[model samples]
Target: MSRTTVLPVTRRATIVGAAVVLAVVALSGCAGTSGSAPEARQSPSKSQSSQSSQSSSPSSAERTPAPTKTTDAAAAATDLTFEDGAALSASTLPAFGLEVSALDGWEQTGEDSSVGSREYTKSDGSVATITQQRITDLDPSMGDRAATEQLFTAAGMPAEQLEEQLLPTMTGGTAQFLSIAGHTTDGSWSATVARAFAKPGAALIVKVQTPSQETLRPDLHDILVHAQVVLT
Candidate 1:
């Protein structure tokens, strides 16, 4: 049987293992969660749409014009493919987003429909999963930008200085911050965050079977550097 070992992540690990976790997390969506709920979903519901329309639609007195379709942060993160034997996939989660990228030769496999997680291959020939969810789950107080900052701080990312330098470039959404990994600040053990992303909130997450700070960080940096908003 194909067993997907989706593991969770920690802030401290993100600092030292930034490069490894970044890459692996994307492909595997092994970025952990706090609850039993599934990861983020790509699509919206009819009720949600109707409610949105009603809220956004202008009233007779306030009707200046039709509300132009505006895009959010999640719309900004794009899914891409590369020639460097890296495979990347992205899905929107309302105000948030989820992305994954991996090297070539990693076999693809199907997984159980629970949480809508898809399975993939780990570097050690193990299986992993990808998930989606809201920023709240990652860290309730901080939004996506802040959560990402925490991850970078924990990962000991050198790019952190760049964050202050590129403050204008980063986004702050109500549900964009992502909580990755399922272990403590220390790197001895690993757990998995399931049913991540609270719908009507953020979504899109990756899971990993193992935690490799070396293998995951660089790819994550590359993805964030190259990521752009996809409105469609």
Candidate 2:
């Protein structure tokens, strides 16, 4: 297994949103191409001033390679391996929509059960996604909920800020605060897993310009609801 640590790359706020900027680091682990260095390829942090003459265009200069249709050899080489919702079993899920794929240039690392990162290409290859998975041995319970809450509370900021930035950009479907039967938030679009049967669970989040209301709600709902403890 490849042990890859993604360091988020800060970028110009004028060109990219905070979500997209942070996403550059988060996704690098998931979508790196063959032999690409996830960290090496990243541009300087957003706080660092770049030469004004440097390529100011985000699309041309800061873009990562998009995941296109892979060849048989390429697809076989990609490291996407899931066993019928191994991370989050489909059986334990509520009705929702979801889409996933095995992508190339992804590598496994020494992170508990397994840890892998890869990128997804969508929107005619204009948009890219990086995904990371880490299997662990911690189950949710009354006693552990406190610790879990703490983790979520810390991680939730970026998620919420990203969602808030995205909401306005989102059009079409109704945008409402997600109030699950057993969970709550301080009003944000990011999904935080509230409970699960399995010890360590899986989580998948996509950073794209807010999609249509209908598409955004169902896509996120499915991913969140299906998030369960499956990997042993």
Candidate 3:
């Protein structure tokens, strides 16, 4: 005779036993919708491109005369898919004028412009979201990180759960990837790796909730090595 035991999964259990998924319901586009709709094609339709351009492209008054430091590149590329082992750096971060890359076996799961942030999944089901926010109310007196914490508060990250870390200035000519982990005021758990640029008033943020920091380190390392940002 053989006997087996199964334990129920609890919230705390998930922090270590399973991959983490922290859905940001209050923040629009933080967690994009996932329907039975077929996966997005590598090549977006021309109409879709035109529509996206019309909607997101800034007007003459809004357009920057020149790209800022963190700006990835002037032109956008196609089929720039991010996979587990590969690295990417392109004009992909239009909002924050930056670029981001992560190592590990992760595949993007969903992205809806109206919803904002893109989502990704790991082999173990760990999930992460990438999004950007441009800010203008920065106070240099507070310094880069303190100013960033203020922005974090406004974006809905609670104070208690915040764990801030300093990012390096470069990675063989790439901007450094830094992170913060925290829970929302409402108690939802999340962690985001962010890079802030003061010159142009924008911050590129990537928040992921995994079983633990250990689990996401590899990907974060990849991001740090390849991430690029030019705030001004």
- Tens-digit lDDT track of model 1 for 90-202: 23322112233322335557654434345656455444444432333444333334444454454543232311111001122112223343333435222222122222233
lDDT (10s digit) by residue, model 2, range 48-79: 21332144423322332323542222112111
RMSD of 3: 18.0
Which stretches of candidate 3 lie above 4 Å from their native place?
1-104, 114-116, 136-143, 155-178, 182-189, 211-214, 230-232
With candidate 1 superimposed using the best TM-score fit, by how many Å does residue 75's alpha carbon deviate from the native? Answer: 5.9
lDDT of 3 by residue, 126-217 (tens): 67665555454544344444545555555554434444332322211123223344333433444565544343344556666555445444
TM-score of each: 0.32, 0.26, 0.43
10 residues in a row with least lDDT, candidate 2: 165-174
Candidate number of the best TM-score: 3
lDDT of each: 0.31, 0.23, 0.38
Q: Is candidate 1 or candidate 3 better by lDDT?
A: 3
> Stretches of candidate 1 above 4 Å error?
1-103, 133-199, 211-232
Clashes of each: 48, 14, 9
Residue 73 deviation, candidate 2, in Å? 38
